[model samples]
Target chain A: MDIINNLVKNLGDGIAAGIYGALGQGLAADILIMVIAAIAVFAVASGGFAGLTYAERKIVARIQDRVGPNQAGPYGILQPIADAVKLFTKEDTTPAEADFWVYNLAPIIVAVFATLTFTVVPFAPGVVGTNLNIGAFYIIAIGSASTIAILMAGWGSNNKYSLLGAFRTVAQLVGYEVPMLLNMLPVIMLTGSMSLVDIIERQAGWNGSWGLPFIVILPLSGLAFLISGIAEAGRSPFDLLEAESEIVAGFHVEYSGMKFGLIMMGEYMNALGVAVMFSVLFLGGYAGPILPPYLWLVLKAFGVFLVLMWLRGTLPRVRIDQLLNMNWKFFVPLSVVNLILVMILGKVFVSDPALFKANGGILIQPLAQALIMGASSFVLLMIALAIVTRRVRKDRMAEARILLQRRETNQQIAASVH
Target chain B: MRTDYAFIGVTLVVACALIGVVPILNYLIAPQTPNKSKRETYECGMETVGDTWVQFRAQYYLFALIFVLFDVGGVLLFPFAVAYNSVNLWGVIVVSLFVLTLLASLGYAIKKGALNWE
Candidate 1:
């Protein structure tokens, strides 16, 4: 390695090498490396999502113990590529009765949001496409555009199924985004930055774990994030929007070829971004040893993606009414309680930064804090369950008593009339 | 930001490249025969008539209305978290009250059964 470096150093022109003063040269090299990292991340993310669409189907199939897409290529390795080719070559047809402009643009919105999300995601320390200081905000803003895009596709498609699917999407998304945003609040509270890179960096360091787990510090909030993030990715038991057989593929009912492919790919991209975001927030993004940080990050994100698949495959799609009920009734209350706990946590800890500092290498003050958080969560969940369960049982008992009394009254009336 | 336009360019290029490969690939594997009727819009074994575009429910507007409030409320908390350490009691109260207001609205929606679909 030393010989190769010296040999390469000697081969460069004298003026170019001299202008590359140690400090200046390092700066220029860093910029070039940043550019390259950005490019590579974008390519891999796009291709990776395309590949993941295939993987999603395959994994879901295997869970059901079935062979999926076997005839395409070896182990279905070429399946995504083949699928892409087929979609592209197939005729781009529009319904004669459809709104052509919005129809064309609608498909683009779904694909575009999918691609644009790569800009804010960080694969490793310096590998992010662009570290917008408002990275989290950017994701929410750009990500929600797909809802409008989906709406456009559905409306423009001129199919009843498509319109119904589009409306379902608008409802499910609007419902789920409530809790999704509420859940994400605590992580930003702990990290104190919205940049994806900053959040990950705060959780990780050059040599070792941060010792403090985001999951530990903000437990219920983290779980809420998981629940809402699952919904955000449109997986079950929150996938009523795209409930196949019932909705006939929903709003994309009329779309075919590349247009359909774009919407499908968009779903996977949202999943990818969300899985990574979930990891960064709760799982200590890239906080591991023995493996390069980027690899660790992918492993963490992949783990989340698999959990999503497991959810979609195992749980039945929740009823639309129950889905909205859970959001408004359950998720809303828990998130509120969690937010209060987060605020209290912020006041107790952040008010005194000294507690977090290294004092003779002994972790200070946070152990009790973590225990209090745990006990608080256990209490809240139990109380919520107790309240909800009691109310439900009470209602059922009341109904049963009513039926019994009515039966007795009817029998008495029959005897009197006779 | 430069990556944005570069990606658009790449996708266009990829689309073109894939288009070029299809015919050769098709010759090697499958036959390319076009039946005129295949391109027609399918409508449950019936000859399609009239415009496909139709109006849908306006009720999603209610969902959208609730969405704006909560989604905006979610965004509102981001900046608050950044400056949380420096926030005073009044600041906390302000945000708390804001959250409380949203909670009330949600309760009203629930009681009125606006969230129910069936």
Candidate 2:
């Protein structure tokens, strides 16, 4: 029934036929396809989002070598559902003095933006809301509304902690956007197309002939992106906004029940959305051929998701001041430098148009440059890592020595007293 | 993903319906028993009229300002970065010069303490 309806809808008027049938369908066809796509994406987004929450907890537990919430339903699979139920059944507390309009508006605005990412974002081959020419722009534009929503949450609640948290989140996300976009420059530059499909289609190979995957070849860009990306998601090492130990649930401190759950789920959904986008950009979205493209898409998205989880499990939250310093003093300049470097390298490297067209969007010149870039960046990165390692080790040893000295002095004093 | 208005229209409709459903659900599910205490603001059970909206530090503004600057910089350069494959001497120069302007603005902002936190 669905397939036949979809087929019938696939034929229609000018926009419906021409625009909608980019997948070769009509107006009605576009609508049917869109409905199916929405249902599929919404389901996947929700289920994946739920699973992600469970996964993060389990990963954190594993890294700490402790059993996580495994009792709920076979390795805590049902824990997210249980949590959702709990939140829904819990008290719905609205502050007496709160601004009713903005308070109500905040979560609605957030959830809408969170789901908006799905429209331009293709989950599989020819399956999306609207493959606008301005797909990338649409994602960014829709994403900006989230900042406004956070601002609304803070102001509506009339709480200092909420306001501060909202401010911090806004700041962090805004700060991270630059480096994140900068990181994408090399990929977009390589693809020579703004469309996400074009980006992924460029990375269609299992083994990079010239270097590792464009993603790995551009490790600095990826690392910078991931660092800021994690910040953008408000996860560990950059989760100063929530800082549960300090701010006590941050901007939604006064929120409870379904409103809070909606907000929380909305955030997780955004994280999942970003993970998918990152995979499409850097890891070749839905590209593996043996399995279906959607399977490959999920796999790549999960792979990116794991990176975020891994970082969360391993790294400590940075101080607020340190976070600011890192963004402004380090990441800002670094991203600019990276953007410039990629631009220069693009000219120096990808000079062959025939080769670029022959090899589907990527130039052999960029591939070669990527090889050299990877090797050199790896070496420089290793040195930096070593320096950081040495400094940390020295600090640990110094602390140990001080502790020993204190113990020995205490022992001597006891012996003298005896 | 074809860009069509009708398809977008359907999507917007569904989203709107979902948005509308929430408020209806809230009214239905919420236990509304009229009571003066329930409606009163509770901060240690005191009287309701007070300022809960305290102004925050200005450091956050600096962070936001810097963020917008950098994000705009990224947005401006993405096109140029992607178009750099043509191996045109002039194209490369234009990008460098464009990026330089952004960097110069950033540097000036830093110098002026626009990025500084109190």
Candidate 3:
């Protein structure tokens, strides 16, 4: 047990030294590996886009009790490839009235930002493309680039629907992002690190393990993060960005052929990015028993993505007003309250001497903290439920009173006629 | 750690190149026989109408403006949260005050109906 654990722990250092030795101890080899890894991340993310569409169609079809995309290959596994071919062969259409430069530049910007997020995702120890100190924050910053890209597409397309779609997209993103960022605080507070790899590592080991994932401890924050994340991805029930019935595909309405394909690719890539981040931040990244770390991360991300797809299939799209209302009135307030609750709980019960390292660093006592936060969150949830129920009952009473008054008025009029 | 950014730079270039190259490749191999009709801006097959550019709602701008304030505040809180384990109770109290100020702004925004969609 000791030998295997030591080997597993030193895996990253071993790989680094091995590469250094093989490359004759120079910076060139590191750069070469970095470049290769960067390209690989791009390739994987793009491929993830293809896989996601297939998965989405299949899942939604099963939900609707129908077979989907079964023509192209066995069970439609090759449908994405078929899609790529069709998109490639279709005529690239550019509107005569469109702004030439901005129209041409928007798709590229979207694709680039979508791909940029992959740099910070750690699939396993020694497996990340680059582990920046501000990995979590960096993801958020990179995400903002998509907003600019959407605006460019909307304005450049020279279409009313596209412009309106862009406007809604901006509102949805801005509304949800505050709560999303706030929801992340508990994770950061508990872990005391911003680098994703470090966060994962802090959740490592038997005694110090935070129950294998932060989500287990902070369920309320986890729920808030998931919902906000879905909004951020522009997925249903918050997919007002491309609400086809209202705006005819939103910001990308003007794009066709390969350009349209690029826009779709960016969207799917963003979804995959969110899934990966959620896995890393809450599900303990790549930590698991028995299975390889990278595989574990992949499985967890896939599981999260599946849940997202399930929500997409089951829920109807919300109107733009309702969408904004949900975010501002419900999610934002809940997230903030959750953050304060977490902070208080951490301060009161989580600052024990045993939880601190001899070197003044803190080790999360997962069991203790989980016991505290879980109970607090449940109490918080119950309070929210109670408030909602009370408001509902009050509304029902007012409605009943109005109905009774109308009935009495009708009875008096009948009596007067008799 | 700083040098790791070079990887990101390379990744950006590669991403741009991939997006740029694929469409150009499609243009190269795909038959492009565009007539005046094909080149026209696609509406649901109606004749070209007035200018395509139209005014949009300012409600989006309101949310974005508020987003700017909150996002910056969130960024400021990042350091505090990252160092929370080591920070003393006084430090926690001070940061809590900072967060409370942010919450106060949010409450003000709510009271002003800044979040009202209609």
DockQ per candidate, 2 decimals:
0.26, 0.38, 0.61
TM-score of 1: 0.79
The regions of model 2 sitting more than 4 angstroms off are A1-33, A205-212, A351-367, A376-418, B1-9, B19-27, B30-50
lDDT for each residue of candidate 1 in A280-339, tens digit (9 for 90 to 100): 777777656666666777898899889888887788887777677777788877797788
TM-score of each: 0.79, 0.81, 0.89
lDDT of 2 at B95: 74
Q: Write the per-residue lDDT of candidate 3 for residues A1-56, one digit (tens) a residue.
A: 43453443366456657777888767787766666677789988987898889989
Query: Considering summed lDDT, which 10 consecutive residues are worst modelled in model 3 chain A?
Result: A355-364
Q: Over 4 Å off in model 3, which ranges?
A: A1-27, A209-211, A351-366, A388-418
What lDDT score belongs to each candidate, Candidate 1 first?
0.70, 0.69, 0.82
Q: How much is the lDDT of residue A119 in candidate 2?
A: 67
lDDT of model 2 at position A339: 64
Residue A250 accuracy (lDDT) in model 2:
73
Q: Residue by residue across A1-418, what tens digits does model 2's lDDT show?
A: 4443233224323334455546655556656756655555456666777888899889878988889998898888899989876765565677777899998778877776677677666656666556665556566666677878888987788766677788888877777777777777777776777777666656774234321355666777767776776777777778887778876667787777677776876788778878887777766776664666667778888888888888778888887766776677667676676666666655555536674553333456445666766665566456655765686689679989999999999999999999
Q: For candidate 2, give the lDDT of residue B47.
A: 63
What order do candidates take by TM-score, descending? 3, 2, 1
Better of 2 and 3 by TM-score: 3
Interface RMSD after interface superposition, each candidate: 5.9, 3.6, 2.2
Q: Best to worst by lDDT, what's the order?
A: 3, 1, 2
What are the clashing pairs of model 2? Answer: A9-A28, A9-A29, A10-A25, A10-A26, A10-A29, A11-A26, A21-A24, A21-A25, A131-B1
Off by over 4 Å in 1: A1-39, A205-209, A349-364, A385-418, B1-55
